[model samples]
Target: MNRLKNCGVAVALLLLSGLTLQAQDSTALNQSEKTIKKYKPFDANLQLRSLYIWRGFKVSDAPISDVDLHYKSKDGSFQAGFWGGASLNGNYKEFDYYVSYTKKGFTVSVWDINNFSDFPNANLFNYNNGSTSHFIDAGIAYKFDFKLPLTLSWNTIVAGRDTYVKANGKRANAYSNYVQVDQVLWQDEENSSLHVFVGGGFAFGREKNFYGDHPNIVNSGLTYNKDLVLFKYHLPVAATAMFSPEHKTGTLQLVANIF
Candidate 1:
């Protein structure tokens, strides 16, 4: 608890320091306002992908399609979005909703995850029941503006059916947690970049099964992304190579987004 308090204090201090710096620059404030004014409030994107993978789980062997719709506040401080994925061959399906708040480089968000592919009978509305389909995750993230921009995030499932067995043979919420670090190596456009990321899950809770039953590195990858204007429409393409050292498996995927 003390450590968590300290972390909260540190994030508050960083965000406050950033705000102080921004306040000292009138030109920067004006530019930010201009950028906010030109920002669109809503966006939609559909992605076609070679496969469906999350963390270390290859959820689907068939091709995948993903859709996202989002709304953001003008100042970019708050956002709400729906994200859904489906396998082209009807092997996998997922739907999730998230809302986030950001201050400077710090962010916090809550996600409602509905994974229907694993158990078709999982009830989305069954919160107190043992067979609920919904899982809730809370996350905190920070992005550093250093020379090599870096992002760090921690997410933990706090509620729902993700479970573990207690010593007494009772089912309990696992609170499975995952942490990741990402760094951008190159960028030629606002939406296009080359990045490297590494992530792992804590062994406790449902992570035992979620991350191969032990505390180990699960998802590490290199990704290259580019946004192009084709036929006067914005299209984004990404190529990724992901490796799971714990599972001794690797995958390569190509993704294209149509907006």
Candidate 2:
């Protein structure tokens, strides 16, 4: 229940922030660094955000609760730590964490998930089964520059979860390719930016991709940001609105940073 409590606290805080503040979002919220400067060898951007997709928030099927904590360090290295709410139909559980690294168009990482709070209704519908499944993957990406502003990357599951979903779950694994891109527009508000994102992901299930191909999932949003000094930390604030074609809905997200 500790994980649940923490997730609840984080959600409450994020929702409360919406009430106390009114701002609009961008690049840092997603994967775009916003050409504030050029991508330098030793440049790193600290990120933090809470995403509330209109459909994700309202989904009676699968609610979306996500907290994004990522750090892109010098040498083009990146690491992201994430925690999300319960998944209704996926093998994911109360906690799913990942650590990834990238360098010069190449990337690799190890990911693991834990499901301690097995819901009573939890079945093949949604549950990783209070088990820990780990996997390692590697991939490469190309960054489009001075062109259409796009990024192309290829990845392989490389390995499967050591365990399977609950008895009501599928015995297969998840695998897919990811393609995403972002464009930065000079919006002039606290070094804010407008971004365009498009991604295609395919996962192989025990049965037949259990879910589906979900080939085209595109999102577009705006982000306003400013770095401020707060008790010895550089705080970045962002507000965003985006839409995905699959769910036929939109999302309004707000996130802040302290570095």
User: Which candidate ranks first by lDDT, i.e. highest?
Assistant: 1
What's each prediction's TM-score?
Answer: 0.79, 0.48
Give per-residue CA lDDT, model 2, range 84-199, as digits (tens): 45434543344446777876655666654333343435332233423323333446666666333355656555444433354786654455444455565545545555555554
lDDT of 1: 0.85
TM-score of 2: 0.48
lDDT of 1 at 24: 78
Residue 225 alpha-carbon offset, candidate 2, angstroms? 4.2
Per-residue lDDT tens digits for candidate 1, residues 3-45, read: 9999999999999999988787977889889986787999888
